[model samples]
Every structure is written in structure tokens, then in C-alpha cells.
Target chain A: MNYEVHNWGLNVGNVEITGVASSSIFLIGDNETIKLTSFYDTPPDSYIVGSLVPLRHPTIEEGTDNG
Target chain B: MDKRVAHIGKTRINSIAYSSMFEIGDANTFTPTSRVIAVQKEGGVETDEGFEFDQYELFSQEPSNVPDSLTVQQKNYHHNPNIHVENIDVKGISASSIAQLGSLNHIDSVSRIKHIRILEKEQNQNDLIE
Candidate 1:
């Protein structure tokens, strides 16, 4: 009997992957003036983000529901 | 002739006496005198004129009664892109192996890894107001 052994096999494992995923950023600025009157009146629950200057008549009331 | 002469002499003597007496009386009694006086007075008058004013009454009513003349100022804001990392993952994996048989069993292995990255950003901003 011939005493000879041949081991032929292939094994592959342990893989590593790396990457960089970045995004761009943007910043915006705004400045504005608003006017309130009888016809185009401001809402009662309006969110004010900047300076607000309101010009109102003496006889007229603010935030009155005319509907 | 004697009577005519006597009459003429008597008439002349009478005329001469009358003329002399009248001249003496006029020169003695006729003295001229004159006097004058003046007065002045002032007066004033005043008048009153009528005045008229048209009184206007202004009343406050409901907003529906008033005319719609008010306007609203609208502002259009600029847009900016907001970017951020969306996803990061391994795309694929590849592996290969070689077998060598000289005296003992030997195996050599190699692997090639791939990766993928994704980025996302905002194209427009949301509506701020109605």
C-alpha cells in the first residue's frame, strides 16, 4: 500500500469594507417687514419669526372674526 | 333977471348943504366888521358778517361695511440645499482560493471587498406661509 496523502482545498473568509458617505449643508437667512390692516389682517395664532410692525386704525379692533 | 339969479343961488346953496351933511354921516357911521366860525365832527360805522360750518359725523361700523383697499406684502424666500448622509453599506464581496500540494496540504485564500455610499440633500424648502 502506498502511504501518500494530498490535501487540496480552498478556504476564503474575513473581508473588510470601508467608505465615507458625507453630505453638503446649507444655511439661509431672511429679513422682512409685514403690515396688518382691515382687509389683510394677521391671524390670531400666527407664528412670528422676526420683527413685527402693526399699523392699526383707532376704531378697528384686532383679530375680530367677521365671518 | 334978478329973480332968476336969486332962485338959482338958493337951489345951489341947498344942494351943497345936503351933499356935505350926507358925506359926513356916511364917513362917521359906516365902519366894516366881519367874523367867521368853523366846526368839524367825525363818525364810525361797523358791520357783522355771517359764518357757516358744515359739521360731518363719522361713525365706526362693521368691517364688512368698509371698502376693501388694504394690501398684503408678500416675500419670496430663496432656497438652499440641505445635504446629509443617506446610506452606507457593503455592495458586494469577492473571494478566491488556491490549493498547493508539494509535501503537505496547503491552502492560500484571498478576498476582495466592495463598498457603496449614498448621499442625499434637500432640493427645495417648504412653504412658510399661506
Candidate 2:
């Protein structure tokens, strides 16, 4: 699946992909303008487009890793 | 030290160098110099310490009710009861920035940024997946 990423802080170095139940992959980041592709069993890949920053997208799951 | 007694409503007022004390019959409002750690409403609305409001209803109802100086987390469990929020990490974020983020409709984790540097080399997919 392809998703638009945005509203992440510039401090985020890179996004980390994690596989949930059954072959669901999630792409997580703080903020930026990028296009990402998530594969069922494979890790996601992202490409930063020009300087077109997008709005916040619903991708990062709540309280999944931050402990 | 100065002490004044008012017969209007049996109120006693005492003032010393730095602080002032008030004893009134009716309600009393106090303004703190620092941030408020917690808030408890009359009808079972109890926010935890560190300005954390556990009641998702309050946030869903009126997100603006939350103080700007405090940090907060809003989960849409009421709208999507079956949704399970595993984790959300937001740190080092300023109050103004959080307000700009607006509604956290489907977000799970968030963190504040301290610096930014473009990656010269492309990231490998295998390295990102865990």
C-alpha cells in the first residue's frame, strides 16, 4: 500500500517499519514530506519528494514502541 | 505583617512579604505561579498528575479545554472502540507546536525534533524493517 507522510518533526532521522499481525506493515516517523510504500511481508520504502510538505497522515500507531 | 477582617461574608485576609492568605465563606480561586500538575472536576473528572487527562471523553468533547502549558495525549477509543493504540511517543515538543498539529485523529506515536540532517545515502529496506 502507498501512503503520504507529513506533520513529522524534522528531528526524525528515519522511519522504522514494523510488521503487525499477519503481514501488516506500518511506517512510523515524526514529520516530513515523503511518499512511502509498504509491502505485506517486506519493509516499507520511502522517497522524499521536492519541498512539498504534506499534512499529518494517520499512519503512526498510538503507543506502539515509545516506552 | 497586615491582617484585615471583613464582615461582609466573614472573610479574613492576611498578607505577608511574599504571600497572601484569604479565608472566605464562598468559593476561593487561586492562581499558581507554576504549572498546574492536575485537575479534578466535581463530577468524577480526575486528571492524573503531570497534566495527563485519562478521560478520553473530555478530549473528544472539547480538546481546547486542555491547558496549553501542559502536555496531553488524546486517543480516539470512543469513536473506534475496537481500535487498539499500542504506543505513542511525543517528547521535547513545545506547547505551540502541539497545538498546531491539531486533531490527532489516527496517530499512535509522536516525538519532538531537536535537529535535522538530510541522508546522503539511500536507506535500505531490509535495515528499516524489524
TM-score of 2: 0.13
Cα lDDT, all candidates: 0.20, 0.24
lDDT of 2: 0.24
The 10 consecutive residues of candidate 1 chain A with the worst lDDT sum are: A20-29
lDDT of 1 by residue, B69-130 (tens): 45654433222211122222232211221111111111122121122122244222232221
Scanning candidate 2 chain A in windows of ten residues, the lowest lDDT window is A34-43
The sequence of per-residue lDDT tens digits that candidate 1 reaches over residues A10-36 is: 222322223111110011111122111
Best prediction by lDDT? 2
Q: What is the DockQ of each candidate?
A: 0.01, 0.02
Q: Residues B16-110, candidate 2: write the lDDT tens digits.
A: 11111122222112221111122323345433443443332332232234244443332211221122123332222211112111112222221
Interface root mean square deviation per prediction: 51.3, 21.8
lDDT digits (tens) for residues A1-67 of candidate 2? 3333222222223222221211111222112222211111111222454433443335758766744
Count residue pairs with overlapping backbones in model 2.
Answer: 15
Any runs in candidate 1 off by more than 4 Å, and if so which?
A1-67, B1-94, B97-104, B122-130
Candidate 2 local lDDT, residue B15: 19
